[model samples]
Target: MGKLRVKVDLALCQGHAVCMQEAPEVFRVNETDGHYPKVEVILEFPPEDLREKVMDAVRYCPNRTISVEEIPD
Candidate 1:
């Protein structure tokens, strides 16, 4: 699997949990504060199926806080 860097814009994020609901493994919203402490989860690329799920998360983010950048080695 290829590597992808995901970054979240906290300033733009409105504490919405849509990203979290879409990709809990990659993005999570704090239940106490309803905010994202750190949304970006830059681990090794997940499996193909999960990649699709992550893509959905990025695409569906209400605040458009998530971004996926593919890195070429």
Candidate 2:
């Protein structure tokens, strides 16, 4: 498998934190005082070993904001 590139659409994100729940190592939800929580990509290019969890994060995102692309090494 190739390296994985993960991205999140901030505009559409609703601070659900599902991605963080699914893949804590790759995704994080930042909660601010006034603003809505936002997702942070801790690992933009996670290793192949994390493909399954990363895909789970992508699949389970309620807003479908998370995206993953496979990059050839």
| lDDT to native, each model | 0.68, 0.91
Per residue, candidate 1 scores C-alpha lDDT tens digits across 1-73 of 4567677777777666777777777666654455455454544354456677688888887778777777675
Clashing pairs for predicted structure model 1, backbone only:
none
Q: How close to the true structure is residue 6 of candidate 2, measured as C-alpha lDDT?
A: 95
Can you write out model 2's per-residue Cα lDDT over 1-73, one digit (the tens) per residue? 6788998889988899999999999999999789889999999999888889999989999999999888987
At residue 4, candidate 2 shows an lDDT of 89
TM-score of each: 0.70, 0.93
**Model 1 error, position 6 (Å):** 0.8
For TM-score, the strongest prediction is: 2
Lowest lDDT block of 10, candidate 1: 35-44
The list of candidate 1 runs beyond 4 A from truth reads 31-49
lDDT of 1 at 54: 82
